[model samples]
Target: MDSGAGTAVGEMFDEMPQEKRARIDAGGEDPPESSWAGLHADALGVVLRFLPCLADRARVRAVCRQWRDAARGRGVAPPLPLLVLPRFRFASLTPGGVLSAARRAWMPPGLDAGNACCVGSSDAWVVGAGQAGGECFIVNAFSHEVRRLPHLGTYDCSLRKVALSASPESAPDWIAVAFMIRWSRPELALWRPGMRSWRVCHHALFAGHIDIAFYQGKLYMLWKFTPCLFAFELGDDEHGVTISRMKDCFIEKLLPTTLGSTHELSCNMVEWHGRLLLIIRYYGGYQARHRVKVKVFVMDLSTNPSVLTEIHSFGSDCIFIGSGGCKSFPAGQHGGVEGDLIYFGPDHYNPHDAFVYSMRDGRTGPIFKPLPCVTHASERNLGFPVWLFPKE
Candidate 1:
């Protein structure tokens, strides 16, 4: 691990109790100095495997020379998804379902969270843009490393969402896509690493509030109310810039009759297990705390006409839905229950409350406990919780 990585792990341990550190140092029993140093490399690798948390792994590496060598030789699994809020703060959801504040000294200098909005997250990098100045940049939340990108001009405030094709660590050909709403009309923009300016695409079909996702080398956008989906191929050629409508991919037809009323609706598009999933959220009352309902649909593009199928079960996969973006991960991977379940409530206005909806059995309840950092009075002032996956 690098020095920055070691510092992050040390910070996490700083919050732990001295008694806990003593227990870890003892390693269950007193052992001869030679015996501890004589442990085989393979044996140490086995111990490191169980320490899935990055902080835990880093702490182990700092224990001694032998342990650091063992950690360097072993492969570490990706860290669990973290919850990121404004002001450069992070919280991790433990396997026991408790939300704990993570160590904070990883933010770069002058990285203002008040005027910044996280539009996208990929490969552990939070793609953020200045809401007032049209400035765009990428920052590694854990490493405190920052990469400044070209500004998006005066349309930055209009930018509602952004997605990255690949992480900067992977390659320099990575692309950043942004969906902006100007004058109540939506526009798509693309920027490559070496580009001098963003390539803007304005079309009538891009109108209305929408959500964007990059999956399988293609960019997808879904209009909030309508079932229309616009697909764009990602490449450097002119044809790659053109937006094509997937005529057969209509979602409104699969919706229940109860959704056709005057209720406000928000739709999210997510790609999981090589399939496109659409989640529709229905808001009832006109007030801020409105009654909410949700529906899940998967698009069957293999069919001759690409029909939308309403699924009541997600099997072993669980979906995380929030204003930032929707993501699906294996339930067992995170010690969560299997079957169709939706974890919702990363709200900017109501961060203290989270609800779990079970589509398999049709039940809803408060499963997500509020984090200590978010208070009812400060909820409106703080940024919404954005889910983040540590970089590989």
Candidate 2:
């Protein structure tokens, strides 16, 4: 681990150290030397929770009825998402950085991680809308299930980004929202259970570099151009989708970079605790790698102007923003992943564009610095690196 990496607080993760290891037998079967089925329910639950690999945990649940019941008792809170690398290699984000000896993340059995362009991920679900005329679907990693969604014919434009309101494991009412860009036409595509087809609407608010996020009871879109926000409420009746401007589309705050500067800015909106955050990333113009700068702001609706106020610290919690999904994560919940930081996953052609931003001293560093397992050699056109979270 890098000495300059970070401090570890695995204890705050739960009732025990964050790094828990289980003696996962081959094929998830109990050893013949002991009666695995005879173990206490709580004891079995602890082992199931500690399993480093999601596939192993899923297999453990299939061992027997007793094991399945134990697996139902999940963790206290949503653990940090697994950093899904190119070729489906999964690593855990820790205080020491990405670490994974098991180095595995579960996905739908047939889903091709290499060719698939995943739009968004939340809880345990990953949503993908590939080529325009191709298939679009939502797959559950833990359950190993996939649901097909509607796709436009000859549209020739794929979904740019997507966000989920909740995980499928939780309930059937979760919603999936996508930013659809077809030629010069931009719109919002939405779907939920029982919907025959996606409910979409063409709107000018979809223009500019936009990222969508679901918070509270409404969906929000942040336009990277002037840094404006648009909120929408989904309806099942003739309303279709109700769209409104947040604070009437206020632009009180602007990107930090000034004109004549060879830099680029990208923004993402996420919900942290009860606060909605907008994290703007600035990098060199030529490439995603550069003197990277990150700034976070909390949406202040109480104010008259309702501006995005810049925040210096994230306390102990941290933020993860990328093509897969953007959100605020609790402190030290997975491995040694510390807080007061921001993990970046820019979807540049460069697969190694990912990095970490520390709010403590305001600096950028390698995301895989502590772990030497990642060697992005021979990897090409590996779209967005995904962050796969657990299914609760």
Candidate 3:
């Protein structure tokens, strides 16, 4: 990975855990064949850049001090997301035909990714309530840096969904917005990494909010009941986050032409090319095994009332609707995959299932599992799997 590929994961093992380092030291000096560690810096860079496997690259970094230094802050961006599954197991999505990469020790000492309630994600961080302490936190998948959130009180992972305003590496004001249940009523929790507790905000208008996204420093919410769109600052001062019911962007600005009932349909709000796009999934019914169809629309906020324009393509860009948040990527640059497609699920009914949704034909293809029987897991046994996309 180059600097643009991000430094977080590339330098993940720079500060190796004590025990693991001791084990490596216990093995004593490596054999003569281990002289690969002394390879020239330029040569090391070329090798790491061309290495197809993330796990192999990580191993090369762990070889010796000189190699570790070269591997630090450099490498190719993972072609696809590392399939984050229970017990910290990760299956690297290596595009087509190539072998998948494996995950080494991916966490610090205490976080239990197996039981952690992963709510949302932005960039390379996974936001969720850690299983060990029942406290909420944002953990960097590569660096294993844990920024704890405030007390969850009685609420846990299954009841909420959270998002970050911006990545911590690029922005210090890492505001977190969570739409969760509070005392049987829908509530909004806002906090930064160091906050003592979340700023609990309740808006009667947002009771029906179905999904949320950060757009140009503001929080935009989609309400299913009223077919309304709401926006407010996802920011803070010394006093903490500020919210007001009076700041509704549009009381009846229906972003979707015909909003579906909560049970029959679901939508994800994605920020695409500086414009917010809404992806609606028609699952047919509550018992439907497959999605009937999918639709995409660009929310033309440039207009007075903000018209929703149905679009058939995203050019060379594609979107990932994950458990945490919707991600848009210029996929063509990373791999040979075309744009204008969406990767959805690890389906609700079948945990092993996922689909590629093409907007052109409004059809679905099976989501890549990396390998057969790799992603199969009991739905209730652990936290749901998610695609952890890398970013700085």
Candidate of highest TM-score: 3
Candidates' C-alpha lDDT: 0.63, 0.62, 0.63
Compared with the true structure, model 2 gives a TM-score of: 0.75
lDDT: worst 10-residue window of model 3: 1-10
Per-residue lDDT over 88-134 for candidate 2, one digit per residue giving the tens place of the 0 to 100 score = 44556544655343243444546664455667777766776555546
lDDT (tens digit, per residue) of candidate 3 on 1-392: 12222223323333454455555557754434465766888788777655544555666777775686676555554445555544445555554422253343346666655566666776778776754236676788766788777766764323356878887787886788887765667778788756788787876766634677788877888763344567785545686876643355462445444535543556667888788887777666667747567777777765676677778898877788765577787666554555678877542223444667787777777655344343455433444556677641
Which residue pairs show backbone clashes in model 2?
Answer: 94-336, 94-337, 95-336, 95-337
Model 2: residues with Cα > 4 Å off, grouped in runs: 1-31, 35-78, 85-89, 99-114, 238-247, 252-263, 284-288, 333-336, 348-352, 369-382
Write out the backbone clash pairs for model 1. none
Q: After superposition, how far is residue 273 of candidate 3 from its true place, in Å?
A: 1.7
